[model samples]
Target: MKLHPTSDFRGLPPAEDALVRYLCAHAEALLNAAALLGDRPAVRRTARLFEELAETRQPLTRRQHAGIRDLHRLLSLEGVDDPDSLEAACFAEIDPASPVVEEICLLTDGLASRLAALRQAEGQPFGMDLSAAA
Candidate 1:
């Protein structure tokens, strides 16, 4: 499937809006893997994302579930018939970047950086081109 169909979310500022979109992408991907391959590994990853979202204590709705299903259907076209092999290959592809724990650290870093920027913007004076920096 198309990993990112468009960067439309760029119109949003980098904070809660942007970070939530990015995390949703990650969560959707994991759920997609589970739907396509019946992969428990993907389910676990998706559950982690769910937990993170839950930390905010926001209520989940039907749309999110639909999003996961749609992504799974689209990505499953290649016929990832064997989940074990799929997970193994996925891990192998990322192994060179570091172990699993460090990989998660990097992902969390991206989310935190975007979220922090948004929070900073909230405290900044509004309606100005403060994004200008040297």
Candidate 2:
């Protein structure tokens, strides 16, 4: 799959825009991984989530924002000790010589880095508690 550049999220607050972009990119990566895994159901579900996020301008609640962070962490293949998880399994099947997998990995890494930078600039700690707002 060809990786597209991030979309310009106009008419959204900076934070909301960042969150939406992050979710969209994350979902895109999941969709690619699902394709590689031949999991049609995952592809459909992730595609729906990506479309919903791309079209919505609604502000994310604290919990939803935290969910993004958690999901990003779950999808990250770096430093994970679990061998049976989806991320690990997908990564295990990836060929180091394959450009598609490499592109997906790079895109995912870039998105995660961008999200971390956005959180830092907003004075938010990584994985900050959202329950406090409940």
Candidate 3:
């Protein structure tokens, strides 16, 4: 998929705008790395999902979040030894000092936290049962 410049997100609520921007940046970084790594097909799938969510201003479902997490895990586990070196090679096309990888990690963590908060706000207890305390 061709990388398109993301539209301005300032119109969204602050939190939503931040989340969308992060996701869009994360997707672009992934696309860049995927192109260099020749893993475009798999990464493109996950990246597109993120892009779509960002564009729609919709919160991710737990399943969708899990899917992205799983894809990330798989990517990370592709080679056991010297993962950083492998990643550096994959991202060689982009400047090594570029903050894409760091930003991607931060965004992923933030997205997970945001998703959990949303779930809690929706009254969905992830692993705790409040019924027993009642």
TM-scores of all predicted structures: 0.33, 0.60, 0.43
Candidate number of the best TM-score: 2
Cα lDDT of all candidates, in order? 0.45, 0.57, 0.51
What is the per-residue lDDT of model 3 for residues 56-131, given as tens digits with 9 covering 90 to 100?
A: 5344444445545554443443432454654445545555476765654655466566444544655667544223
Name the runs in model 2 displaced over 4 angstroms: 1-11, 19-30, 37-45, 62-67, 78-80, 126-134
Which stretches of candidate 1 lie above 4 Å from their native place? 1-5, 14-98, 124-134
Ranking by TM-score: 2, 3, 1
Poorest lDDT segment (10 consecutive residues) of candidate 2: 71-80
Report the candidate with higher TM-score, 1 versus 3.
3
Per-residue accuracy of model 1 over 38-119 as CA lDDT, tens digit each: 3565566456545544343232233433333333332332233455566444544444455543535555456445435653
**How well does model 2 score by local distance difference test?**
0.57
Which pairs of residues collide in candidate 1? 15-118
For candidate 2, lDDT tens digit of each residue in 12-125?
667567657665655656667555543454466555556555555555555555554444554465424566655566556778798876766766676577666666656779
- For residue 61, what is the lDDT in candidate 3? 46
